[model samples]
Structures are given as structure tokens and as C-alpha cells.
Target chain A: MKTLSLRNLQKTYFDPYAGSQVTAVHDVSLDVEQGEFVSVVGPSGCGKTTILNMVAGFIPYSGGEILLDGAAVKGPGPDRGVVFQSFALFPWKTVLENVGFGPKMRGVPKADRDRIAREYLELAGLSHAADRYPNELSGGMQQRVGVVRALANNPAVLLMDEPFASVDAQTRMTLQEELTRIWQERKPTVIFITHDVAEAVFLANRVVVLSKGRVLDQIKVDLPRPRVWDHLMQDETFKRLSAQVLQMVRSA
Target chain B: MIASGQRTGSKTPGSGWVWRTMNSLAGAAVFVAPLLALVAIWAIVVPLFEVNPRIFPSVASVADAAADSIRDGSLIRHIGASLLRVGLGTLIGVVTAVPLGIAMGVSPAVSSFLTPLFRFFSVLAGIAWIPIATLWFGYGFGAIVFVIFNAVFFVVAYNTLLGVSTIPMTIRNAAASLGARRWALLTEVLLPGALPNIVTGVRTGLGFAWRGLIAAEMIATNVGLGYMLFVARDFYRTEVIVLGMIVIGLLWLLIDRLLLVPLERATIERWGLVRRT
Candidate 1:
């Protein structure tokens, strides 16, 4: 089943400085299946983030339609949870409260929401940090909270926009591995937008390469599941797929 | 594993509250040392210079004046009146300004219309209000409170507006995506997000209000510390004037250190991310 469908999606904005209209995303169409993990990969200015933002209902699409479970997305809603690159955890809230925010918003009782939060926090290996604030955590840990906070909402689809781009290289690998592990267990449909070719290949079932705001190609990852850096780093298929995506991205 | 409540911003995380409190007391003593040194200078200079009694009262004479005021209970009344005025005015100012500031924050049109007015008034907020306040309310409590209100209202409103607007777009988006309704966004996100700045505004505004309160009280009221100072001047009671001045300074210090600083430290500094950083 198509959980998220974008039909001829387009975004055009007036450039005040340039005194003309600029098309950021031009005539793009895609479908993400239920329980599918799709990574949208592109070079800078390819409008990959813009596409994710549109799907997340963060920004209005100037043209075409984005349907989630055959329903049009109007504005940001709990149905489409987003994980931001900045690790936008509520600094004022403890990690548990941050995770519980969604359920709380849904009018879940405090005890039940906290239980849900604790469950997600444990899933992220962050059970110990539940009482800590976002600013108190390292970048990697904060992003872990970011991931679960979205998941705890039980959204129809998760939108991640370069969520690990800001973290250190070592932490990024760990986060990517953790994300795949969580994805395998939960099977939450996700649209992961990234500029990183290897990351896109590592995380998604299918990698959609975007060029100049359009889908250039979609690469299916036939790599086996339970993806881990320890094995995947040395796997021949992983290297080949990554190289292909990297070449496309660098050229595009 | 750090205890959430015990996490003092920039302190060794999970430090015991008792330990922190004792250490803060030591820190306060360090802070007060310079003021004590200034008083020592005052003590020595007055006697050494052979200063006239009418010029600057000696420290000992100021102490005697303090004793006399304490005995008569006049000082307590004055202080109580001044405290009540400042407290009521600030309460009113904060209550009214916060919602308006939130309105300004959430809507661009409201902000555009109000921003210039707030900015303009904040600069001219304190003593400038005193003249008009007295004319509006007549010479007494109402006038002085009005002056204090004017001093706090604009600055806090402007700061709150700034605080809300400056919150990153991502955070707001995240909150919305988490199903935060408009009211929830205001209460949970915007209010807490803006608290550090709001507290800062209160701290700054109170400084202005304190000055304005004193000026207004001197001009318009027969009681309070400012009135006490103004009346003492007529009798050439330099000791009484000096005592009132010292009390004014100490009261402001106490308010800032005990009330405002701790407030900022507990909520915003440790929990809510401060607006600037």
C-alpha cells in the first residue's frame, strides 16, 4: 500500500534579490510504501530537504499533491512526525518528557504517556538518560531522543531531514546502525532525506536520487537485512551501491 | 546518571542541593566583600577628612539613624509601603504584558504594530513616566505604582516578544508535528522558551522601576523610602538620608540576587535554553 504519495510536486519561490521566480523542486512524483524505508538522496540545491519539508507539511507545495494514506497533508500534524537535523529536542523538558510530548498532545494520561516515552527511550538505549535534559546530552544522544520522540507519536510516516549530518563521523555511524536496528524492529515507514550517499544506501530499502529538484533514479538496495557497519563496511555489494550513488550525487 | 532537578547549569552535574547552597553562600560572601570594603572606605574617609556633619554623615551616625528609625517603626512602614507598591505594580505589569507579548510573538501584524511602540517606550520607561503618572493618578500610591508599572510593562513586553520570535523555526515545527495545539504551543513551548528573557526583562525593568518608584514617591507621596530621604534632606539629616540610600541599594541587591538570579538559574539557565545561548 502506498502510505505516502507525491504527484508532480513542485515548489516555486520569488527571489526578491534576483527579482525573479526560482523553482526549487520541479515536477517530482514518488510513492513510499507502507512499512518501507526510503532515503531521498541529492546534492546541495537539489531540493531534497524542500521535498521532505513539503511531505512533512512544514511548507506549502506550490503545485501537485502529497497524500498520506490517501489523505492530503495540510499542515504539520502528529500523523507525519519529523526528525530535524538540529536535534530540536525541548531543552526545558527531560528526555522522557520530550519523548512523551506527542502522546501528551494526543491527550494521553500522564502515566500512560510516560510509559510510552519510557518504552521508546528504552528502544533507543536511552533508558538511563530519561531524566536528563537535551542540552545535558551529547549530540548523538540528543538525536537518539529526537528519533524516539518522533516514533513515540506513532505517526503514519516519519520524516528525517539530514538528522545525523551534524553529528561526528563515529557517532553518525553508530546512529545509522541504531536507526536501522530500530527500523527493522518497528518497521516504521520513513522518508530519510540526506546529502550523504553511503548513509542513504545504508539506511533505506530503496534510495531515490534527486537532481535539480527531480527524481533522477531510484536504486533498490538488495543488501541483506540486520545491516551493521561491522559487516556492511566490508561487504562488496555495499561498496558498489555506495559508489554508484556517490558518483550520481557528485555528478548531479 | 544525573538527578534532573539537581542539575545546575554549568555546575558539576548532579551536585547535591545542600552542597550547592553552601557554596552559593560562600559565593555571596565573596560578592558582598567589595561592598563591605566600600563601607570601610566611607567609614575612614568621613572621619579622616574631618567632613562636616551636614555633608556626608559618618558611618556611626548613619547606624544611629538606622537604630532611631527602627525604634520609631517609621522605617518599616516606609519599606513596607515601597515593597507593596513595587510588588503590586510588577505583578500587574507582568500579568498584562505577557499575553500581549505572546500575541506580538505569534502574529507578525501585532508585532509590527507594537514593536516600535514597545522599543520607544522602553528607553523612556522609568523616570519619564513619573510626571504623567502623578498627573493621571494624583500625588500618592496610585501615581507611584503607575510609574513602576510603566517602567516594567514596556521592557518586559518587548523582551518577551523578542524571546518568542527568536526561537528557532525547527523547534516550533517539531512542537507542531508533535500535535501541540495553539494554546499548548503558547503554554508549553513559547512561554518556557521566552522565560529566560522574560526574567531578564523583569530584572532590568525592576531596576528602572526601583529608580522610578523612588523618584515618584519623593515627588508624590508623604511616606516610603524616597519620601523618607526627601524629608530628611529638609532637616539636614544627612545620616537619615545616607541610611535610606544604603537601604535602597541593599534592597535592590537583595531582590536581584535572591529573587531574580535564582529564578533564572533554576528554570531557564538549567532547564530552558537561554535565548542567546
Candidate 2:
């Protein structure tokens, strides 16, 4: 059964100063099943992030509906956790505090929240840096904290917008691996957005190609799980899937 | 794994609060040393020039006057009066202005409508209020405090409004997504995010208020630092005047360095886009 569904989703922004109405996300439809990892890949200005934002309920959709387990989303809530591209961990909060903020907001006791945050931080291999502020961490570590912050709530769906796009290639690969490991362990339905086709193929159960505000195609990755990074580039199936998605993206 | 290992792992340097504070104080002393040297030069230069006592008192004579005031308890009374007026006026101004600013700033239309109004008042803050204030309150503590209040109010309000509005929308959105209700959003996100600006506003507002307080005391009040200095001028008591001036300068420096600067630094370091110096 689909855990999250987007039906003919559309987003239109009217720029008053420019006096023009531009549609950011034109009619796009997709379904994400429970425990499934879906990556939305698109060119610049294609509005893949807009779709993710809609799922996260950060903005109102001009047309169509977003449903979680057949219930329409009203606005942003703890049920759907979003990880932004800029690693929007509250700078004022310590790593543990940032991770535990969702639970604290839900009236979770301080001790319990700390334990949960620490557990997630350990999973992200950031247990030692729990008390440190966001500014003290590197870009990669900060993003790790961002991911755990969203996951600490045990949300039904995880919405990520180019989570690793800002990091260096080496750090990106490491973060991608860490993310996959956490997702496997936690089993939250995730909708990841990225412009990198290779990253989309590497981390997704299914890669949805988007172009000019529409989904061009949804390509399923039948590659084996516990996908190792060192061997991924060598695998015939991984290479084929990546090449297909890359071709679709380029053609668009 | 390599990246994680490279992340300044485990042994976080400068971890303890006491050590960090000591480090900062040492840094502050470096900045303060130059001012101390200027005082030393003043002590030497005035005596060497053999300047007239009525024109500019020597450091020794100023010290003697300060000692005399301390013995008589008038110096304490004047300082206490000035501090009380500034403290009360600033407290009232901050309390009222912050909420009003936030209310106006929350809406684009309201903020734009009120921007010019606040700008006009902030420009006319401090000394500009003295004439009307004295006329209304009749040359006493009330008039002096009113001047200080008027000095701080508009500037703090304007800054608080700017602070609240300048917060990035993404941070607010992120907070909302994380299950923050209205009150939580304001206290947790909005307040903390705007803290740096609010602190800056207070600092600037207090500066204007301090000057206004002194000016108002000189013109209208009978028991404050400014009044003491003004009264000393009638007797050609340059020593007393110099003593009063030194006290004012030292007090301002102490407040700015020990209190305001540290507050600004901590807030900006914690939540602002600007990094620590």
C-alpha cells in the first residue's frame, strides 16, 4: 500500500512586482509505498524541490492533493519531517538539542528526549559531538545532525531536498551511505530530491525523472540491497540503471 | 569513515566555560590597555604644562575632588540618581517597544506603514524631547527620566521590528514542520533568531539615553551627575568638573565592555549569520 501519494500536484507563484504568474510545479503525480526510498531527479528550475516542499507542507499547492495514508495533508507537522539542502539545524541549539527538538515540542520529557537524540546521534556516528553547537561542526556533520533531527520524531515520511548537494564528492558518498544505513534500520518512507542522477540511482528504490515541472518517467532499481559504495560502480545493474536515468535527464 | 574520523573528534578543545571566559577577559584587557596609557600621559602632560587650575585641573586635583565628593556622599547620591533614571527609563522603553515592534513587523503592510513613523521618532529621540519633557514634568527626576525614556523607545522599537522581520522564512518553516505551535514558534524560533538585533538595539538605545539623561540633568534636575558638573562650573571648580567627566567616561566604558559587548557577542555567536570575532 502507498504510504504517501501526490495526485496531479501543481504549484503556482504570482510575482506581484513582476506581474507574472509562474507555475513552479506543473501537474505531477507519483505514489510512494511504505518503507520505500524514492529519489526525485530533475534539471535546475524543474521544481523537484517544490514537490518535496509540498509533501513537507511548507507551502500551499495551487492544484491537486497530497495524501498520507489516504488522508490529505493540511500543513507542516511532525508527522512529515523535512531535511533541507542548507542543513537547517537551529544554530542556537546543540547537536543533541537540535535532534531532540521535535520530541521536546511534543512534550517529551527532557531525559527521554536526550536519550533518543543520543541514540540517533550514535547511529549517525556523532555521539561524541552531542553538546557542540551547529557552527562547531563541519558541513557534513551538520547535515548528519539535520537528518537525525528530522528522524528523531519517528515521522511517517521523510522529505529531503538535495541533502548532499552542498558537500564535497567524498563527503557526499559517505553521507549517502550513512543515510541508506539509517533508512534501512529506521524504515521511514523517504522522498529524496536531487539534481544528480548518479546520486538518485545510488540511493533510491525507484528514481523518478522530472523535467520542466513534470515527472518524465519512474525507473525502478532492481539492484541488490546492502549496496556497497566501492562495488556499486562495478555492478552491471547499477551502471545500467544510472545510465538510463542519466539519459532520461539529459534528453529532458 | 575517513571523513568522520577527520571531524575534530572526541577531544573538543576549549570545552570548559571558565577557561573560555578567562581567554575573553584577557583579550578585553588588550583593548583596554591603550586607554590606560592615555590616562598616564594625561597625568604627566598636565603637570609639565603648568596649566592654570581654573582652566584644566591636574589629575591630582581631580582625584582630590573625587575623594572629597566620596567623603561627603554627594557623589554617590548623584551617581545613584543617574543610574536609577537610566535603568527605569530603559526598562520601560524596552518592555513597551519590543512587543509593539513585533506586532507591526509581523505584517509587510503594517511594517511599511510604521517604518517612516519609527524612523522619524528615533531621529528625534534623546535631547529633542528635553524641552517638552521639562515643561510637562517641571524640572525634576521625572523630566530627566522622561528624556531618557524618549531617547531609548523609538530606536529599540525600530530595531526590534527590523530584527523580527529579517529572520529567514525557511527557519520559521522548519520550526513549524517540527511541530512547533504559535507560542513555541515565537519563543523558540523568532525570539532567539532576533536576539542579536534586539541586543544591538538596546546598546544603541542606551547610548542615546545616557547622553540624554546627562543633558536633561544639566538643564533641569538638581541631584544627578550632570547637575553636579553644571553646579561646579559656577564656582570655576575645574577639578570637580574633570572628576565628573572622568566618572561618566569610566562608567560608560565599564557598561559597554563588561555588559553590553559580551551580551551582543554571545547572541550573535549563538544565532546570528555573523561569526564571532
Q: Highest lDDT among the candidates is held by which one?
A: 1
Per-residue accuracy of model 1 over A1-252 as CA lDDT, tens digit each: 889999999999999999999999999999999999999999899999999888888899999999999989899999999999999988889999999999999999999999999999999999988888888899999999999999999999999999999999999999999999999999999999998889999999999999998999999998998999999999999999999999988888
Query: lDDT for each of the candidates?
Result: 0.92, 0.88
Error of 1 at B223 (Å): 0.5
**Model 1, stretches more than 4 Å misplaced?**
B1-18, B275-277
RMSD of 1: 2.1
Model 2 CAPRI quality: acceptable
**What is the Cα-based TM-score of model 1?**
0.96
What lDDT is obtained when candidate 2 is compared to the true structure? 0.88
Which candidate number has the best DockQ?
A: 1
lDDT of 2 at B188: 85
TM-score of chain B of 2: 0.90
